[model samples]
Target: MTGKTVGVLGFPFSKGQPKGGTELAPKELRAAGIVDRIQALGNNVIDHGDVDLSGLPADSKVGVAKNSLAVGEANKKLSEDVAKYLKKGEQVLLLGGDHSLGIGSLHGHTQVQPDTVVVWVDAHADLNTPFTSDSKNMHGMPLAYVVKEMAQFLPKTPGLEWCKPSLSTKDIVYIGLRDVDPGERKFIEQLGISCFSMHEVDKFAIKDVVEKALSQVDPSGNRPIHVSFDVDAMDPIHAASTGTKVPGGLTLREAFYIAEEIAATGRLSVLDMVEVNPKLGSPEEKEVTVANTVSVTAKFYGSKRQGDVPPNYVIPRPQA
Candidate 1:
């Protein structure tokens, strides 16, 4: 494992979604020892605390997007923060309020590494633009704002101007998809974006699927990688605490393998795990889901399940 400095940024704002309580994830995950576990892997973990967006100024709603003004303002700040950290060469672990935060995260990541590859792990394809969105929930429309083809359709909102198609369709791939919307499905098909649904995972297996995905996104194996993980990608049995639950999703082991494969590349720059809503499930369900999220995150930072030898070992007892 490469011991790069890790910057943890938490977005506790949940205005992007139509639900409540996802805003509590950052605090809960921190309390569950996310930072300390990364530190155990020998990486320097810096907790940047949470991005508070409760009192931020918002603009008028734009077109069909809900909370467009608030989401834009918050994402603008998040993008700036992400850019600053990446510029300093620190790997970022963004604790998200929802998948909607992806807009800001990708915007900021691309500002530093324009050719960064995005790996989206989710049951739903969040590729709906404001114009195509039926729910008007900004969380489901984040990818639309960051795709090159959809840029012209985006409104010229004040805080959202900084967002552009920092990512091309070829540079982005999706895994664990099962609940894609009709519009998103058409968009993905038309753009020929690489996607591995549960059916593909069962056919090709996770390892092969990941290898193929890497080949498509990082053919030369030199681009920076950003993984956006939505907890809903996991089967509801393993992650019942998330807002949107899909029945047949990735197993816990499969989810960890995905993170492990990305970490093994040693090119991972930013990781955002979102959509974990503690308020939606029972106490046991909440605990299990949170634990699963923490473990997957730890694996991304090289947390060896079997542990490892200390690098700086002085002779505590001299060998004879």
Candidate 2:
């Protein structure tokens, strides 16, 4: 994060899920000053505007990957754009419409770093493939594309036609997962990917958990790390405006602590504040959506209280 130019890129396609709340996330968050907040961190911040999806559904009709072709197109363009920023030695903060944006961002970062690590924070594994996904939402399948696990099912596109693995399975560390899909769970287990489910978070602690995630993502001397943060990863109490709010998510303090600690590492290259929905819960919930998103983004950018103490996160070793 040191000497990195911060750029804001928006991905406003959210047909990936049944809910349509995420399309408004960027606009709402902008009005709440997410851009201004980034500039205050003393970094060269620039907003690259949003991708023009041309109102295509998350999937397309021209590919075997059903509904996922258009998703690939948008993501490929996003990857190209974000890759340019990364190549310029900039820290790109992607404003996501849903977790689906991870596809493009991951592609972009991997194209530049080639060996970057991804720390996916969410309430679900999001590793489902076209064959495995019962819901067919492209959002839940981004990790599948990022990891290059299933190539045969992917659509054929110029830059995205082939599956070049982004982050390795072992390199990925999923934190704050709870309501994972069944097939997705088997995929994660088969891959032996590191994960700290909500049960683990409750048993151990957030501090230790964050430490473990950070270590796994960057064991080789703090290489470039991308954090794809989905607001639903936080406990529903902390963020109830998400389209897919799961119970028992990371608390606001714990979520911010992740950002703060990751920023402290200085190896953190890309920061994504995703899944901030403005159309959920009571009136109070929408109001808090941007605030929580802003808080975590601030923490990621080296903003913190002088005497604030990190949380006591107990990260117990996995059972062999």
Candidate 3:
């Protein structure tokens, strides 16, 4: 991943769920030195700023989906921005307001790199349709909107008419899932998507889980990778500020291992770092969540646990 120009885009809109502080993730992450950390890894970093989420329609629920109009419009704008940055040959790093932002990121990525494979790292399967969702939050339904196989199961959502399902089920792989819903489990089994739940992680180990996930999604190992990582995928101890954190999630080391492995692939084109809510926890918890999130993100951009030397560095020598 050296020499790559990383484009950082923030989605400061959180209409996908009933949360407020999530909209502040981009600002918080920036304040925590995310930009400097990535730049230190010897890659050129460009902060593209946050996506505009203003003046969107406040339409009522479209079927069982809540915040339909606002979520759809914001995602449309996000998709365009993502595609623009990708066209400029920069690897896109999306800092999200919530998991719902995955809808737009995936849509825009497929517009430029249709053959990209997805590695969705989250505690929840997030494959529920509007009808299947009890909360009606769009955050839990992003996968349903983007997956081609799930299209038939979706209702005609008003604001989401622009979202055409483009990704095949076979092109996606899941990691770190532990709190999957019944509907999501049905879809996973019926559609044959490769999933590495906490059960699998415990049995096969993180290294093997990652290797098998990549192999199943992109057997040729040449396709571009898009990792949609929800910080809630980590245990509540590591990420207590998220909205829907389930216990017994990935450890900090396991999370870093996954990110490091993805970075080594050299095919990571877009990454979504999401679900950090600064308002949900105490100052100490928020600090821990933000720090952990930043660390995991840096790993995906070439920071290594062993250590990293800046590009073109030379050891100090005695002066003549």
Candidate 4:
């Protein structure tokens, strides 16, 4: 409760990938009592509401990357907002518009603590660049944008680039990685980013992996941390509402363990729960799944909401 303040920011932009229901994620999660859920967790919760990620022109002057303007614009604002909250001493919980939102969230967090290390929890590697991503989905390209300074090949935009180009190669770690494209795989190798794939989890156990992860965070024990979590990182059996659901992800219990340990570390600052697609789930199941998500999120934040808010506060944009 003392490490950081808690702020929720919802982003409804889901066009970053091949998904439609993510735009409805915040609304569905709200109905499922996300605010009340946080309130129940005993942490101070403030919902700054969702950022406006609507109304993008059909055409982007940029080639290769789809919806570059929309994605970039929303992320720019998201980054600014996230930066604002960290400045206010709030622990940021950025609800997913999609995984691509990580670019903005990380940018904002790093703007404050440029040395912050990010623990990326997702089923996919998320290391794909526009040139290599066969899917052409911007969701898969955040890592590329953040780590590739000259890689900001936004063919059309007039230099509003906030790309970080290789966020301290030592600063990024990957856990729960099982699915990855060949190009992304090569990039990971080329960058020397640490990754504990599902295979590693099987051989070494979650606790060991987490311990190794913390060691990688900062050998000096001083850098801040940002957790970029893709809900799809969990086994799809737990919540099959994301666009990129893959098999063999972390169990619910294991996820909570990782989060709890991170919270206890005091270095945990911002957390991102991305790729929740309400449109993909059945009505009743959607409600139940979202409730679980908020619960998991609260554990990472340490406590829940207070007297004025509901149990599950909508976690939209990251900046308070």
Q: Work out the TM-score per prediction.
A: 0.94, 0.88, 0.98, 0.88
Tens-place lDDT per residue, model 2, 1-320, is 33557888888866556677788888888888888776766556788888776745344242434356666677777788888888887788888788877888888888889777888899988887766777667788888887855454444433246446567787688998998887788878887888998888888798889887777666765588889999999988878898888888898988888888888878777777788777778889888877888878878877785643323435689899
* lDDT, residue 275, candidate 3: 90
What does each candidate score in C-alpha RMSD? 2.3, 8.6, 1.0, 7.0
Best-matching candidate per TM-score: 3
Which 10 consecutive residues of model 4 have the lowest summed lDDT? 150-159
At residue 63, give the lDDT of candidate 2: 43
Question: What lDDT is obtained when candidate 1 is compared to the true structure?
Answer: 0.88
Q: Provide the clash count, candidate 3.
A: 0
Best by lDDT: 3
Which ranges of candidate 1 are over 4 A from the true structure?
58-63, 153-159, 306-320
Task: Report the lDDT tens digits of candidate 4 across residue range 269-299.
Answer: 8888888888886876566568668767866
lDDT of each: 0.88, 0.77, 0.94, 0.77
Worst 10 residues of 1 by lDDT: 306-315
